[model samples]
Target: MKILGKITILLCGSLLLFFTSDFPDFGDANSPASLHLSPYFIEHTLEDTAVPNVVTSVLADYRGYDTMFETTVILTAGLACFLLLRIPKRAVKNRYYLHEPTGVTLRFEGDKYPQESDVFKRIDSSWVPYDIIINFTCRLLIHFIQIFALYVVAHGHHSPGGGFQGGVVLGASVILFAISGNLRAAIKRFGEKTAALFSATGVFIYAGTAALCMVLGENFIDYAALAPILGSDRIMARSHGIFIVEIGVAVAVMAVMIWIYYNLSSAGKQDEGL
Candidate 1:
C-alpha cells in the first residue's frame, strides 16, 4: 500500500511538472496572472480601498466574498472534525491518583477521586511531573504571543501579516499551553463550547457585514454601502470594513485551529491530550 501510494504521488508530481512547462516562468512579468488583474490591484488598491497593504485590500475588500467563504470553510472543517471524533458524554468508570511526594498510585472505580486527601492532589489522568521551567516560560510567553497576534491582525493593512496568518499564531499559544502544562488547563481557559461558538460567530461577522450592505441598498458585499452605518466616507468605510472582516477571519481561524487540535490530539475524548 505504501509503495503504491508513493508511486501514485510520483506520477502525479511528474504530470504536474510536465504541464508546468507550458506555463510562464516564475515571476514572468508578462504572465497572464501578472498582466490581467495583478497590475490593477497593485496600482489602484490603495487609492480605492484607502489601505496601504495592497494584499489586504485585494483579499478583504476586492475579494470580500472569497474571504468570507474561506472563513466559512475553516468553520466547516472544525465542525466536521467535531462531528467525526467527538465522543458522547458517558460516566467515567475508572480513576487514578498519584501521591506526589511519595510516588505511589491509588486506583478506584466509578469516578473516585482524592477528596480531603491533601497528600494526593487531583491530577489529570495523563499528568506528568510539573516542570517549573516549562510552566513558567509558557506562562510568560503566552501573553506576548497573543498580543503580537492581535497586532498582526490589526496592522495587516500596513504590514505583511493578515487574519489567517495571525490567527494561526494565536492558536499556537493555546497549543503551547497544552504542551507545557496540561490539556485540561488549556481547555479550562478556552473550552470546546466557547471555541465552537466563536468559530461560528467569526463567520457570522463577515457574512453579516456583507449582507448588511445589501440591506442598505447596495450590491452584496459592497462595503462602500457601509459608509452611513460606520459614519465614514465611502473609501474610508471600505478600509474599515476590510479591517472588520479581517477580525472575523482571525477569530474563526483561531477557534477552528484550536478545535481541530483538541479533537485530533485527544482522539475525540478531549481528555489528557498531548
Candidate 2:
C-alpha cells in the first residue's frame, strides 16, 4: 500500500508540474490576466467600488471571497496552535513579587505570600519587570501604536493600509507589551479567552456580511446588495462593504496574532513567558 501511494503521489506531482509549465510567465503583457483583467480593474475599479485605491477595491470588493478565506486561514492557524500546544494551567505553587518601595524582589514557595500590601506587586520574573527604561518606553508608546493601527483599519480604502496591515500593527503592539514587560501582564490586560473570542468574531463579521448579501437576494459576496441597509447607492454600498470586511480582517488578524504569541511564548501554559 505504501509503495502504491508513493507511485500515485509521484504521478500526480508530475502531472501538476507539466500543467504549470503552460502558465504565463511573470510580467508577460500578453498574458490573459494582464491583457484583460488588469485593464478592466484599472479602468472600472473606482466606478464599480467607489474606492480611490484600486488595490483596496480589488481586494475588499473584487476578490472578497479570497480575502474572507484568507482570514479563515489565520483563524485556523491559531486554533491549530491552541490545540497542539495548549495545556491546562496548574495552580502556581511558587511566585515572585516585587517591592516597589525599596526595589526589592522576593520569591515565595507554596501558597504563602505577603499579606496584600500596596507596595508589593506580582511579577512574572524576579529579574525583568523593574526596568526603568523599557517598561516606561513601552507603556508610553503602546497607546500611540494602537491608535495608529485603528487609523490604518479605518482609513485603509483611501491609502496604503487596510485590515491586514492594521491588524498586524495592533497585534504587534500587544506583542511589544509582552516583550516589554512579561506575558503574564499582557495576558492580564487581554485575556486568552478574549483573544479567542475576538478571532472568531472577526471571521463572523466577514462571513456574516457575505451571508447577509445572500439573504437580501443577491449573489453571495455582492456588496451592491447592501444598498438598503447601508442607506446608500450600489457604488457607495460597495465601499461600505469593503470597510466592513476590512474591519473583520483586522480584528481576526490581531486576535490570532496575539493568541498564537501567547501560546508559543508560554508553551501553552500561560505561565511566565520567555
Candidate 3:
C-alpha cells in the first residue's frame, strides 16, 4: 500500500508539472492577464466605478462574485474548524489559576471542586491581570488598533487598505486582549457563539447587498441599479456599494479569525490557551 501510494503521488506530481510547463513565466508582460485584463482595469476602473483605488474597484465591483464566494469560503472554513476542533466536554485531574496580587501561579490537585456553577466552573487556569505593564499597555493599544482597522475598511476606495486588511487588524486586537488578559476574559466579551454569528452576518451582508441590487431590477452585483436608493449617480452608487460590501467583508474576516484562533489555540476546549 505504501509503495502504491508513493507511485501515485509521483505520477500526479509529474503530470501537474508537465501541464504547467507551457504556462507563461511569472509576471510575463505578454501574458493574457497583463495585456488585456490589467490594462482594461487600469484604464476604465475610475470611470466605471468612481473608485480611485483600482484594486478596490476590481475586487468589489468588477469581480464582485469572486469576493462574495470568497467570504462564503471563509465562513465555511470557520464552520469546519468549529465542527472538527470543538470538544463538548473535557476531563481533568488538575487545575491552575493566577494570583492577581503577587502574580503567583496557583495549582489545585484532584477534581473534587465545583463543575456546573457558571462562576466556579471556569475558575481554574486563568491568565488575567498577570502583568501590570504588559496588560495596561496592550489595553491602551487595542483601541487604536480597532480604530485603525475601521479606518482601513472605510478608506479602502481611495487607499491600499480594505475589508480583508481591516478585519485582520480588528481580529488581532481581540486576540491581543485574549493574550493580555485570559481566554475566559476574551470569551466573556466575545464568545464563540457570538463569533460564529458575526461571521455568518458578515457574509450575509455582502450577499444581501448583491441580492438587493438584483431585486432592484438590475443584474446581480450591479451597483448602478442602486443610484436611486443611494441618491447618487450610477458611478457613485457603485462606489457606495463597494463600501457597504467592504464593511461586510471586514466583519466576516474579523469574526472568523477570532473563532478559528479560539478553537485551535484551546485545542477545541475554549477553556484556556495563549
- Ranked by lDDT from best down, the candidates are 2, 3, 1
TM-score of each: 0.86, 0.88, 0.88
Stretches of candidate 2 off by over 4 Å are 1-19, 91-94, 98-120
lDDT of 1 by residue, 1-274 (tens): 9999999999999999999899998999999999988989988987898999998998988888788888989999999999999984344445567787898877767654566266875565666777999999999999999999999999999999889989999999999998898776788899999999999999998999899999999998889999998999999999998888888889999999999999998788786567
Model 1 spans > 4 angstroms off: 1-23, 89-93, 99-103, 111-120, 124-127
Q: Which segments of model 3 are wrong by more than 4 Å?
A: 1-9, 90-93, 97-129
lDDT of 2 by residue, 1-274 (tens): 9999999999999999999989999999999999999999999998998999999999988898999999999999999999999987655566788788997878898757885368987777535646779889999999999999999999988999999999999999999999988787799899999999999999999999999999999999899999999999999999999999999999999999999999998888887775
- Cand. 1 Cα-lDDT: 0.87
Q: How many clashes does each candidate structure show, in the order listed? A: 0, 0, 1
The global C-alpha lDDT for each of the candidates, from Candidate 1 onward, is: 0.87, 0.92, 0.89
lDDT of 3 at 105: 54
